[model samples]
Target: MKREMEDVVIVGAGIAGLATAVALKRVGVRALVLERSQGIRTTGAALTLFPNAWLALDALGVSHKLTRSYDPLVKGSVTNINTGDVQQVLFSEQAIRPVHRKALLEALAEELPTDTIRFSSKLAAIESQEQGGGASIAVVHLEDGTAIKSKVLIGCDGVHSVVARWLGLAEPVHSGRSAVRSLAVFPQGHRLKHEIQMFVDQQGKRAAFIPLNDREFYWFLTCKEENMTGEPEQIQREVLEKYAEFPSIYLDVVRHADLSTISWAPLMYRHPWRIIFGNLNKGNITVAGDAMHPMTPELG
Candidate 1:
């Protein structure tokens, strides 16, 4: 079969892949992004972008677009359910905003050229070939029976990245904990302060509420990994039951959560030592983002 040729090929169109493509485009380097899904995967309800993250976004030229929509949170309070003690924490002068995943994806994708992202393109296997003169090329094969040759192959594919595995990276190990996240929509406006609120029990199970906007907010709960399977409704109920002693506001958030936004999964991470000593790249192939270093989400 005839093989197509390109300068750079990026696998996975998640936050990392899209951002890398935009960064390359700014430097006059065009990259083709391959996504296994049909469209942008906006499964994670939202993310808290710190000052450093915003600086990177600013470098990419998309921070203003997001800043206009989401306001920065400057303070938060953590409550201990076991002791009924609340502690207040203040943030520095830098901006900290929590944005919806969909909006963030769209913002980064907007900076790309037309057809820059190829959806429904799943990476099957990869091989490196010598092109003489001590040069090499990466041959990427897709599940659909198409082959593409590129000067550089970057894997931004998430935790289960095939490229990382091809490079002999160890599999991600479970972190002995599970998390459930979702967005709660308040149609008439939530009327809540623009601050983060968290509650923790004696068992170290924690729940947090973060306001995304006046009409919607993002919330998540982390606990010991148990039988957290089944439908969104079931998961929502589980959260309610598990944290029944939490503040009523938390319960309300879970009760009014958008079912489609609910996501439950066991946290996984690649050992840091392995990443420090393992083969992250070979020839012109390399990995980035979660494909390179995946860790449990503990930023709070």
Candidate 2:
């Protein structure tokens, strides 16, 4: 196979990969992002960006674009479904914004030069060679029978990262839980408060809803892995049936959910201890984002 050379080769074009590439570009370094998918992968509905995340985006010089689009959440309320007890908490001066996953990906991707992201490029294997000065070069082999060499190779390929495994990192363990998420749209107007509302039942099930904008909001339900199954429509019905006792407001949001955006998956994360003592980097190869430390979304 022919060989291509790049200064930096980043695997995966998700949030971390794209953001890392944009950050490098800002500092006069060019990188090539390889994504296995055909295009940008907008799998999840939205993500909550805490103060630190915004600072990172700001450093990347793309926070303003997002700040203008997403409103900061000032407070939130958590309610116990069985006890009917509610706890209200106020946020600090630092802002916490919930943004559409797709928007975030696009914002970072826009900052890079055209053709910076190469879709349909899957990493099949990784190798490295020693060089002068005791440094090393990374060789990334793609599934398409092409090989690329780079001075530095960063893996942002997510929980199932091939590079992470190559570094001998343990696989992400299942949290014994699954979640169903979707974006609910109210074209007329949701007219809901710009705060987060969460509900938890005694059965270890938890759910939360957060407004993304005036007309759209994000919501998710966490339950035992065995509790959810089948197609999107079936899952939608299951949500309604399983949480029939939840507040009418939550059900209303479910009713308005855009089925096309509904997604279901088991939650997985790396053990904290493993991350604290694992081989995060070897030679010119390293891992970042979910590849390094994937955690349950609820912890976010």
lDDT of 2: 0.93
Per-candidate local distance difference test: 0.92, 0.93
Candidate 1, residue 284: lDDT: 95
| Candidate 2 wrong stretches, greater than 4 Å | 227-229
Off by over 4 Å in 1: none
- Which candidate wins on TM-score? 1
Candidate 2, clashing residue pairs? none
lDDT of 1 at 45: 88
TM-score of each: 0.97, 0.96
Model 2: per-residue lDDT, tens digit, 218-241? 999898876566888888999999
